[model samples]
Target: MSTPWHIQRMAALDFEASDKDSETARIVSCALILVGGNLPTDTRTWLVNPGIPQEPGAIAVHKLTDEHLAEHGAPAEQAVPEIAKSVAEVVAGGVPLVGHNLGGYDLNLLDRECRRHLGDSLEGIVRQPLTRVIDTMVLDRQVAPYRKRVSEEQGPYQMRTTAETYGLPWNEEQAHGAEYDALMSARAAYKMGAIAHTPYRDRPDWVRALRTNRFNSLRGVTVEELHERQIEWYRRDAEGYQAWLRDAAKSKEKHDPEAVIPTAWPLRPVPAPRNGGDR
Candidate 1:
C-alpha cells in the first residue's frame, strides 16, 4: 500500500556539475531525498561520468575530480537516463520533486542531459502528467522577503541560511555532497511547512511572526493545489525580475543582450553551449 500524494513525500533535489556554466556544465552528481513518511529516507543519488574535464572551481565545491569520477562514475548515457526514469516513476506516482535553486540550475542541466543522451527531456520520458515541484529557495522568498543578510555567508534566504534560520541540522563536512545538500533542502522544505501549519500562539516568537506568511495558504492544501500555487508564484517572480532588469538596462544603456528571464516556472531548459562533441 502506498501513502496518498498529499501525505506521501516531497522530494528535495540537488546536483553538482563539472563547471559553473549553466548551459555547458556537465552534471557530476544528482541526489533526491524524500521528505514525508520517515523523512531523510527514500533517497537516491547518482554519480555520472560526464566524460568532460572538471573546472577547478567546480572541483573546489563538490570535490569530484576527473580522476575520481573516471574510477567511480557511470557513463552519462547510462546514468542520466536511469536517473531520469527513476525520478519520472516517482513523479508519476504523485511525488512532488522539490529542491533549492532547482528551477534555475539543476533542472536545466537535467533537461539537457536527458536530451543529450535519450533525446527527450525528463518530463517527456515520464509520459504522464507533468511532475510537480516545490522550489524551496523560491517559496522561502515569498514566505519571508525581508530577512536580513549582512554577508555573503549569511545569504539571507539561501539554502544554507534558510536551514540555519529554521534551526535544522547541517554538517559542514558533508555540505556540498549532493546527498547531503538534498537532505538539508528536504529538512528546510519541511520546516517551511511546519511554520505554515503550526498555530501562531503556540509557536516560538520568531516563527510566530511568520503567522501571516504567504505560505499560510498552503496549510491543508492538496499536493495538486500546492503545485499550482508554486506556478503562480514563479510566474509573478519572473515577470517582476524581467521588469527590474529592463529598468536597470535603460538606466545603464546596456542590458543582458539576451535579456530573457527563464519563465519556464520550475525548471527552465537552457540551451547547451557550442561544443564540437560532448559525448
Candidate 2:
C-alpha cells in the first residue's frame, strides 16, 4: 500500500463578512492562514471598501465602519482576488483546506467572491473533487462525545459557537482585522489536532483502513469474515449479560424481556438436595 503524505498540510480560513444589505456585494474582512509544508507562517488580510456603508451591528463587533472603510479600504474587485490567491495557493500545494464550518458557510462566501472576481482562474482551482476540504465541526463531534461551546471565552469577538471545548488567548480587541482572525484559526487548528485521539493518529494503516473501509485481515481469511466473527462474539456476550439484567429487573418488579415470556415456556428452578435439605 502507498504511504499517505507525512507532510499533512492544512489551511485555516476565517471571513469577517459585512452585515449590511447594501454592502452585500462586498465582504469587509477576509483572511487565510497556511500552516504546513514549504509555506511561510504568514497570514494574508484584506479590507474591502465594499462601496457601501457598514451596518451598525457589524461596526460594534469588528469596528470596520463605513467612514473607515471608505477612507482606507480597497475596492471589492481589487481585494477579492488577492484573498482568492491565498486560498488557491494553499489548495494548489496539495493541502486540505480547513475551517470551522467550511461546508455550510465559509466556502460558500469564498466561492461567491471567487466567481465574481477571478472567474475562470477560480473555477479551475476552487471546485474540484480532489480538492480536500475538512470541516472541523464534523471532526470534533465524531471525536468528542459530549461538550458545549462557551461564547467567546478566550476572546472578545462574538464568533459562532464551536464544540472545541478549549480556550486560547487571541487579540480580539483588534477585531474584524483579517490577519488576527487568520492567526487565531491557525492556533485553534494546532490545539484541536492535539486533542483528536482517533485510530488514525501516527498510524498509516489505520488511516488507510478508515479511508477505504477495507480492513486488514490476518492469515488468509478476508477482513469481512474476521469482522463477522468478532460481531458474533460480542452479540453472545451482550445477550448473556442482558438476560441476567432482565431477570434482576423483573425480581425488582421492573420491566424485563423474560417477564413477557408465555407461561408455556419452561421455567427452571433450583433442584432439591438428595437429603431434602434447602436447595
Candidate 3:
C-alpha cells in the first residue's frame, strides 16, 4: 500500500493576530512551511502593518509591537492577498495544510482578514471547503479525549504540550513565533500519522499508555474522508462543551448560557453586517 496522505507532503500554516477575536482581529504575522519526501523544506513568512493598534495582551504573546510593525510590516492590503495566494497555491497542489486549532482560530481569522482587506475570503479564492487541511488539535482531542493536563502552566491540548506529548523537540524561546509554531504543528501531525498507521502490537509502550484505539480507525483513510470525520468530531465536541457551559451557568459560574460554539470546520461563516447588508 502507498503512504497515507497525512504522512506525506503537507503545507503547515499559522497566523498571529492583533487580538483574540477571530471575527475582528487583523493579521500581525503569518507563515507557511512546506516539508516532506526528498524535497528540501521551504518556508515563507509575512508581517503585516495591520493599520490598528496591537492589544497589550497580544503584544505580550507575539512580541510584535505597534512601533515595530509600523516600521517593518507590509500593508495589510498587500500582505493579506499574497498570503492568501500562497495558501491557495498549496491547496491547489493537493498538499494538506497542517496547523493547531486552525478550524477554530487561524483559518477563521485569515478569512476575515481577506474579506476585510481584499474584499474576498480565502474560501472564495479556493472555491471549496478546505477539505485538505488537517487540524492537529482536533485530531488530538479525538484520539485522546481522556488525556489530562500536564501541569497548571500548560493545558492538555496546547500546541506546546501536544508537541511534547508526541516527543517532538520544543524551544521556549521560539514557542509563539508563527514559523516556529507552524513547523512544530507539522511535525506533530507527522508523528500522529506514525501512531495511527502503526500496528496495535507494534506501537510503543508510551502509545499504549494513551489507552485508546481511536488512531486505529484513522489509519489508511483518505484525506477527504478524514476531513469529513473531523466535521462530525468537532460538532460533537462543541455540543458537549456548550452543554457544559450551560451547566456552569446554572451553577452560578461565570460561563454564559447563551454562548454558542460554531461547529464549522476549517472556516467559519462571516458575520452579517449590523444594518443587514449582504455578507
Candidate 4:
C-alpha cells in the first residue's frame, strides 16, 4: 500500500476518559479530524457513557462528570462501533491516524474500551490491523529533541508544549477538550512534518523558531520506515527512563526497581499477575 504520511491525508485522534489509570478508565469522549485540501475534510466527535463514575481529577481535566455523561452521552455499545467505523473509513482511504502521546495513552484506553464493549480491541472491531498510526509524540521526541526543551526530570513532550515549541499556536484556556486537542494534534503534526521535509530556508520567517533544528532525515522516508523508527525510539525512551529512575537519588516518584516498562510499540495490554487471573 502507498504511504499516507502527507499533510493532506493524516487523520488525527484524541480521546478522554473517566479516570487517569488507562487500564481502569472508561472512555468518555473521542474525536477524529481528517485533514485534506489544507483543511479538515471531516471531523467527528463522540460523547460516550462510560458506565462508570468519572473521577474528580479527570473531570477537572476534560470537564465531563458522571451526571453530565448520564444525561447526554451515548452508551459505549452504540458509540464504540461508530468510532470504529470512522477509523475504518480513514484507514480505507489510505490515511493513518496521527496524534501526540497517542501511543502512550489514548490507544491503550481504546484497546480496553473496545474489549469492554465488543469483547475485542479496535482491530477486531474494525476488522483490520491498525498498523498505520503515526504517533507524533513519539516521532517528535525521538527525531526532534532539537525541537523541544527536554530535561532529566521531564521530557517536555506534551502536545501543547510541543505545539508552542514548533511555532504552532496554542491556547491553554481552550485545551483538554477532545475535539480541541484532536485538531491541535493534527495541526502540530502538520507543523512537524513541514519542518522535517521542507527546506529550512524556504519556510516562512515565522517558522524561524524551528529553522535551526532542521530534520532533513525525515525526508525521503516511507511511512513504514517512519512507523518502525518510532518503535525503536519508544522502546529506547521507556528503557532509558527506567534506568534513570533506578539511579535517581532524591526522586519523589514511586517506581518498582524490578518493574519492566513496556518496550512494545504503541500500546501494550496490562500485564496479568501471578495465577493468571486476567490472562
Q: Of the candidates shown, which would achieve the greatest TM-score relative to the real structure?
A: 3
lDDT of 1 at 100: 82
| TM-score for predicted model 3 compared with the true structure | 0.94
In order, what is each prediction's RMSD in angstroms? 3.7, 20.2, 2.0, 3.6
2 against 4, candidate with superior lDDT = 4
Off by over 4 Å in 4: 1-4, 37-40, 146-155, 200-214, 250-256, 273-279
Model 4: per-residue lDDT, tens digit, 64-174?
888989999999889987887787788777677888888888888888877877787767776776677788788777655644355653347877777776777888787
Report the lDDT tens digits of candidate 3 across residue range 117-185.
778878787666688878999999988776788888889999998999889989999989999999999
True lDDT of residue 58, candidate 4: 96
lDDT of model number 4: 0.76
Inter-residue clash pairs, candidate 1: none
Report the number of the highest-lDDT candidate.
3
lDDT of 1: 0.76
- State each candidate's clash count: 0, 0, 0, 0
Cα TM-score per model: 0.85, 0.57, 0.94, 0.86
Worst 10 residues of 2 by lDDT: 261-270
- Residues 44-141, model 1: lDDT tens digits: 88898999898999999888989999999999889988888887877877778877877767777787787788897767888864547777887787
Candidate 3 residue-wise lDDT at 10: 87
- Candidate 3 has its poorest 10 consecutive residues by lDDT at 248-257
> With candidate 3 superimposed using the best TM-score fit, by how many Å does residue 243's alpha carbon deviate from the native?
0.7
